[model samples]
Each structure stands twice: as C-alpha cells, then as structure tokens.
Target: MTAVVHPAALPADLRAATIRTRVTVPLRFPDGYSTSAEVMTFHGLADGREHLLLALGGWEQVLLDGAAAPLVRVHSECMTGDVFGSERCDCGPQLREAVEDITATGGFLLYLRQEGRGIGLYSKLDAYALQDQGLDTYDANLALGHGEDERDYAAAAQMLRAVGAARVRLLSNNPDKAAQLTALGIDIEEQVATGVHLSEANSRYLAAKRDRTGHTLQLSRAGVVRPAKAAAGKAPGHSGMLARVDALVPGLRARAEEAEQLRRLPAVTVQELQDAGVFRILAPAGVGGYGLGAQSYGEAVRVLARGCASTAWTAGHLTEHAWMLARWPREVQEEVFANGHMPLAAATSAPVGSARKVPGGYAISGHWSFASGVMHSQWALLAVQLDGVRLQALVPNADLQLLDAWHTDGLRGTGSNDLRADGLFVPGHRMMDWAQLTGPDNPGSLLHRDPLIHAPMTTLLNLVAPAVAVGSAEYALDLFRHQLLMHKERNGSFVRQADSVLAQARYARAAGAVSTAQLHWQAALSLLPSEGQADAGLPEAQRAPFRLSLALAAEAAQEAVRLAAGGSGGSMHRLSHPLQRIQRDVGVLLNHPTLGIDPILEQAGRGLLGLELTMRSF
Candidate 1:
C-alpha cells in the first residue's frame, strides 16, 4: 500500500467515512435573490462529529474537475450571536456576508458545530459571566480551564478534502484560521477579510480579538464599527417604530392627568402621535402609510399604552378603522383618503341602526355608542341593517351628531361618546355589506392584496380591544415596580416594598401572566392568511379557539393589572395616579361584549366537545 497512495482517500486512522449525502437545493434570500447550492453532509468523522459542506452554484463540479480555486469559509457556530441577533459579537453579520458573497461567486462554505470557540455552550456562558466581571475574552477562557481558542481545524480540512477543494481563497478575518488551513496542506490562493460588525456591546470583545489573535479589524476612534448601507427598497421591521414610540412614553406619561382632565387625549399628545405616524400604520402604502401587519400594530399599541392607556386605546381604534376601510371599493377609498391625507375613522361594528334602501344608496338612522376617538375622526364606520341585511356604512364625520355620553370611571380620556345619525344618505360605494366584508370575494379583497384585509373580520374586530388591555397591564406592572423601589413605608422604618418576598413573587407572577397572554395573542395572529396566498380561511373550530384565546388574553391582562394595583398599596387609588386610571380602563375593556371571558370560553368548550354552539354567528 506504501507504493501508491490515493489523494482522495483519508488516512487509515481517520477511515470511518460512514455516511456521505448530497442534495441540490435552491437557497433564497428575503431580498428576493436565489441560487442553486449543493448541500453535502458527512457523518462519522475522526472527532465523532458531522459537518455540512455547501457548494454554491456548481462550485462542487468545478472543485471536482480541479478547474478553479473556490471562495471558501470555515465558520464556527455561535448560537447567541447568529440565531438571536445578539450584538455581543460580529458572528451573525460575518455569517450573513459570507453567505451572500459565496452565493454570488461559485464557492464552498463549511459550517462547523464548534460553539463558543469549542468551550461548549454552558462553559461559554460561564466564560461570559467571568467576562462580565472585567476579565478579557482570553482570561475568561483561561479562568474556565480552557485555551484562548480551543477550536480545531482538522475536521474543516477533512471536509474540504472530502468535497475535493484542494485550493481555496479563504474568506476570514482570523489569521489563525488561514495558518491552520495552510498547515493542513490545503493551498490558500488568497485571503479575504470580512467586515467589522460593531456595537457598544461587542466593541471590547472585538478589540481583544484584534489585539490578541491578530484579527484584521479596524475600529474608529470611538471604538465603534460602521455598518454597510442597507439595500434599496428594503422595508424596515417594527423595531424602528417601536423605538420611536418608546421615546415618547415619558412625555405621554407626564400628560396622563391633563388628558383625563380634558375629557380626551391631550391636543399635544394627539399631534405628537399623528406626527409619529401612529394612526396611519394600517393605511394603504399607496397613500403613504406603512400598511403594517397585526403583530407590529399590536406592539405599537402596547408600547403606547405604557405611557397612557386611554391614548393608546384611541390610537388603536383609529388604526384598526383604517384597516377596515381598506376593504371598501376603490372609489370609496379614494374619497376617504382624498388629498393624500389619511383620514382618522371611528368604528362601531354592532348592527344597531336601521337603513332604508334608496336609489344608489341607503338612508341610515340610528344611535351608535362606544365610538372611540370620534372627536378626532373625519369619518365613521357605522354598522346598520338595510333591507333586513347587515351593512357597514362609511359616513362623513360632519353628518353625525355627537352626544356627550362618555362618562366613565376608567378610560375617561378615550372620549368614547355616542354618535347619532338621522336619515344620513350614505352612497352605495361607501356602504359594504357586512357579509361581503367577511366573505372571501369582497371588493377590498378584489382591489387590494394586503394580507391584513384578507383576515376574518370577526378575528380582527376581536383583536382591537385586547391590545389596550395588554399594554395597560404592562404599564401597571412597571408602575408597581417603580412604586416598590421608590416609595418607603410610612411606619418610619424605611422599609422598601421590593425587599418583601411577597412583592417579588407578585411581580414575577404578573409578568409571567402578561407574557403568556402576549404569546397566545401572537399565536392566534399567526393563523391569519398572508399576502398573495389563496384564502383557505380558518375552520370554525380554529376560530372558536382563537376567540377563546383573545378572551383569555384580556382576562390575563386584567389579572395582571389587578395584582400590580394591589401590590402598589393605597396610593394607587388616588385619582391622579395613572395606575388607578389603567385599572379602571382595563376593567371597562374586560366588560366589552366581545372580550367577555365566559361566553368565549363556553364557545371554545362547545367546539372542543363537538357540541352544538348556542350562538348562531360563531
């Protein structure tokens, strides 16, 4: 055997080549580019580990034919940085850039499972704990009884050889990776440096890597790394909007009492919200709105509620009404959104009005209550019964008579007063049949392909109120925590409320309940149809469960707010205290006919038991 040695064969000691599998698949990016890649997997290596070899765009064939030096990167796994977008390191950005580059040029990328520089996950967490105590990365590793860099390149070399990549242009910032590959007898034609993904959290770690391990990274005078410009036409996520709302919370909190005294949202707060684009989230993008999805809309409401629940409630209604109006005919939409300005609308979905069918329209006369944000709206979505059929009529705000009927203990600032319309002639174009809106063949569905409009009307309607409850509960918890830390006992002992075990447990329980409620709400939202997909529509059983989940979310929020109020003691009962208002607001929200827990639970239980539901609509 010594007379002739085969270059493709592994050494005798590392001969267990038990499994080799390859599949050609297409890798698509969110940016809409796609390319073919050969995903090769090898198992039972010398280290009893497996590795993946991705050969992009016929690079495997090129390597096999010995015709080119492919662009190669041997990447180690970092779960926190890669999967969770943690800014503690540059691993995520490096991996993303590597994929884009390798996919662009025919190349090979070896993804190794060596996590935390081969220190293992839990040990790496321990190392992180040590680093938090002022130890550098190298010292943290040494303190944890490991080398500064414990990762080995033998498996990477073996995978490269198995894939027939004898020569490569290495894409890496670590000089040690290149030296290790070179020492493994693999030919390195060139080395390409990756970008420096910097943040305040990872600046120290990055500097230590560059100083100690000879990493090729350039840092600015402020120790920050600048990111590359984003690609054109890419829409930002809800994080930016959430950040904007978060910045307004303190200001909004300052005006809560003023808003209650004014019997509506403070004019300044309303203008600030309008300037921040809070009311236009669900408006059509063609009309200069973001047309955001349910998750983002719910999150914005939750964030706004942290400052003032009543303001968030009004904002939520206006945004939701815009979404509902998007289902109207194009002519109606144009009329409502004339002059490129978004029209804030107030909606009452219950069919409480009588409509007489007239030529080219219906004459509606009725009283609708709980019209949140009606004072600031230019239009109203009124539900009426026309010719014994339910219809949603969009009437101009000028046609409706506002009644001062919004007296309530909680959510007084919402200005949810009654509005009456006497023989108002709403054009046929502005009136949509309630059944048509719920059906798959509505005018909105035919005209606009936004996924939000395609969702079940009942589901969307039920989701609106719970957003305020969730936000109010979260705000209540924050107030409770602040009171605990800041307020001392009046018994002259200077005892902190947070020092009590009961207070800690109460905070933990309420936090868990609110968090779980949000999860349920998110899960229900996920079941809705997305854009461009055929409307399969959820089954009745699923809809029942969804309603039950929403009701539970409301109940959970109420419980959390109650707990927070109780934990805050008698000071929370004052009229000026925001917690008292939030408690009252959440209480009123829970009493809503749609979000009442008992009826929803009964419906869900009936569905689960395969029993006939008592309610006809559900």
Candidate 2:
C-alpha cells in the first residue's frame, strides 16, 4: 500500500465545509492481511452527522489525478450488523469483503452514517419487529412512516468532490447508487458488481433487495446456512440462566434495603436465586449443572452484582465453593450432591483453626470469621492446619454453631458471621490438602472432565470478590446518572445537575474507569487453560500480572464508585439511598485480602524486575 499526501487546499465551494481528517491507521483483518487507510470526517453532511472516508492503499493519489477513476463503495452504517456481527443482514460480510477488495486495488470506501436506511436505529429495530410480523424490510420502513429507501447520496457526492475524486468506478449491486451519484454530478466510470453474502437470517432480506430494487447479483435458494449445533451431551448454554438472573434484578434491587436491614440476603431473594439455578453454575455436568467456563461464570456474577452487590458477592462465593467441592474425593462429592440439587457452602482460607489427625479423619476446632452466606449454607469449608499441613475440612452445618457477630458498614447483607466448630470429626474423604487443591493435578482433575474444575485455585479464587465489585461500580454509575437527571441546586436554581460540565466530566471518568476494569478482568479470564491442555499452572511471570489485574479491577471499581458518589448530592449520604450502599459495598470489597493494590503491585513489580518472588503460596 502506498501513502498519499493530504490536499493543501480545497476548492472555493468546499471551503466552508466542516471537514477534518481524523486518523490514518492500519486496519487488520482476520486473515492476517492489513492495509493503511485514512479516516477523514465530514461533519456538515446529512442532518449535521459525520460521515467517514476510508482512502485505501493509494486511492487519494488516484483521485487527485482527475483522469484516474478509483474504485468507490458507498456503504451505509448498520450498528447491529457492523459492530455486533448480527447475521440479520449481510452488511457485516459485505463491509469486510469491500475492505479486502478495495485494499487489493487502490480505492475509496465511503462509510455513510445513514443507519436503518435513514429511519434511525430505534426505528430500524421497530422495523425489525414489524418484519417479524410478516412484512418485508421495505414495507416495515413504510409502516414506520419512512420511504422504501430513505438514504440520500448527496453527502457521498460532496465527500467525493472534497477528496478530489472527479469520477469513480462504483462497487455496488444497487444500480440506484450509480444513478443517484451520477445525478449528484459524480461521473461513474463503470458500475462494478459486488459478490452476494448469503445467510439464513438474511435470505429473505436479500431476495427482496434483488427482486424489488433492481440490484444485480446472483443468489441461490438451494440451502439456508445455519449455525452449527453444539456437540452431543453438551450442557445447555448460560444464556437462559443469565436472562433469568437479569429478570430477577429489579426485584432484588427493590429488596436491597430489606436485606441490609435484616443483615442477610432476603429469604425471598435467596429463593429466587435458587429458582434461577444460579448456584449450579459451577456444579458438575453429570450432576445436572451448567459447568460453565470461567468467563461465563464471571459474566453471570457481574450481571447479578449490578442489581445488589452483597447478594452477588454471597452468591459468587457459594457457586465457586461448589466448583471447589468438586475437587474433593469422588465419594465425598457424591455424598454432598446425592440429592441432585445444588448445595451452597461458605468457606474461609485464613487457617485460623487447628485440626488433630486421627485414624479416619481429623478433629477440627476453630472459630472462623467472615463466613459469607453462612446463614444460607448447608455446609462449611473451614481452612485448618492438620499434622503440619494446610487442608480444608468440609463439615456439615449440623456440627457447626453460627454466632450472631456479623456487623459491618459495607456489604451489610452478606450475613458474613463467625462460625464455631468444637472438635468436629471430618471424614478423610471430606478433607483436601490445600497444596493439592491449588495444584494442576488435583483430585478433581482426575474425577471430572470439566477443565474449569481443574483451573488453578489461586487465579479462580481471586476472581469472585472482584466480580461483585465490578458489578457494584456499574450499578453506582447508573444510579449517579439517574440522580443527575433529577438533581437541582439547593439555592432555588433550576439548572439540572447533568447540565454542569464538572458532573459530565465525572460521569465520563467513572464510565472509563469501569470499562478499563472490565477489559482487564476479561483479559485475566482469557488466560485460564482450556480442556486437555497441559497441567502446568499459568506462567510465573503471568501470575503476578494476573494478580495485579484483579487488584486493578477492584481499584478501578472503587474509583468509579467514589466518583459517582461525589457527583451525587448530599441526599446520597442517606442509608436509604442505593448509591451510599453501593459506595460502602465497593469500598469493603476493594479491601479484600487478595484484591489489595499495594501487595499486588509489589508482586507485579518483583515479577517485572526479575526478582525472586517473596511470596510463593499462590
């Protein structure tokens, strides 16, 4: 690809336009092919909207030559198809093919912002709903008071002229594009044909375009392409569970205050979660659980947290404990899961207890604090030192005594009380060595086929609390935005809080912080090893970075929540306000032992500096 110089001057007629060059960068494709393209923006076109000009290869030079006719494609923006890869239309594939074709030969592709054939996005969605009601795309637009094709080419013509393209070989199946551009004083050297992109979802839409719009392309109706089916015996996907949880969010948000007041997740909320099958996310597939991967589980937790952080926190820990319990001996797993229903377990790994080894098991006695969800758990996985080895002993709730000592300013609804166990005898099958559980070749690795069950405990355990923090931050941002819309100055000024520039800046900062944290969290989740891969844990160099990323995620959430609370007025300080609760919850979550920033940063710095690790437990 050759580079072309930007024009030094524009013609008298185009001088008054609000045209500016935005960026020129390499656009990479999935096939490893890349090309440089200049992204020029034209602001004063089509309802004061901005249109983009992607001059590929040496197209700008070709256009400046006046006699040379560059290949041009006038493309319309489709948010769903282009950004989301939605197969409801061929827009995404067509856009990809056009970029490849234009890059091969010097050409220009104009990305017009005329979404939904100029009916706008929401209207396009309404049109989609209408299309589902047996109307074609054109008729759906007409039903919405829009023309069959409302997009105009005047902007494309003006953009071409401003870029010094006097004539062009148009790449399009629609002859109307050539006719419209020609009528707008753009000389069409030739009308080139574009290949048809066919799929089951867009077959009818394509047929309508070809039959009614005079588009020239060969399309076949021999077979409709469909997505490949999942493998046999595969568990159902998480979409249904996520949708169920999403539907339950409003009710959970309504009862958040009640949960806080009761110092526990409301019984109704717990029942709703059970009904949604949320606790079974990490259960074994053979036991009728989803056995979702880490990424899917993290996403579900994030979604649940958006409504109520304490509930999400308790739920995440309990679900993760199920996954951990899968690492125990097969007999123990069967003993716990014999009922074919998901079980909730509260856990603490601080090793604040002592266990004495006996012939069959260990006599465990301890008082564990911070036992989140203990009120709802059927069992407890208490960390203890037995015969100089750290192990987790699974004791039935019947043997443990719960103390009424859960008082906290943050995460108030977690019911994270202290539990006392006095010389309880846990069977050998019910205890697991901490080292073996954290290693790659754990008992669960041999018992279950799900790789998520075998994932490194160090990495997986750190993710649960952070997931709730991320969700709470997102919820805080939403609450702040809503507050801004309703807030007013106290001195009788009628100006809305959102109208203030400072508030807008804070909102932007908070949003950016949350997005950055989510990106980091997703990156860490992606590093989990897949099924049948080597058993070695994540590389040492990556371990610290992963740990640091978890801290960053928590810190980012803290920052976002702080910013949101600051923007909310004095009323936000009240206990009834969700913002105050969210702020306090995120604050406590960020202080989690594994999610502290200083320790994580030091470890990351040590790893980057090639120093011997000071801590090796992970």
lDDT, candidates in the order shown: 0.75, 0.77
Candidate with top TM-score is 2
Best by lDDT: 2
| Residue 101 in candidate 1, Cα distance off native in Å | 55
lDDT of 2 by residue, 6-31 (tens): 22322335322446776987888665
TM-score of 2: 0.60
TM-score of 1: 0.59
Q: Which pairs, if any, clash in model 1?
A: none
- Per-candidate clashes, comma-separated: 0, 0
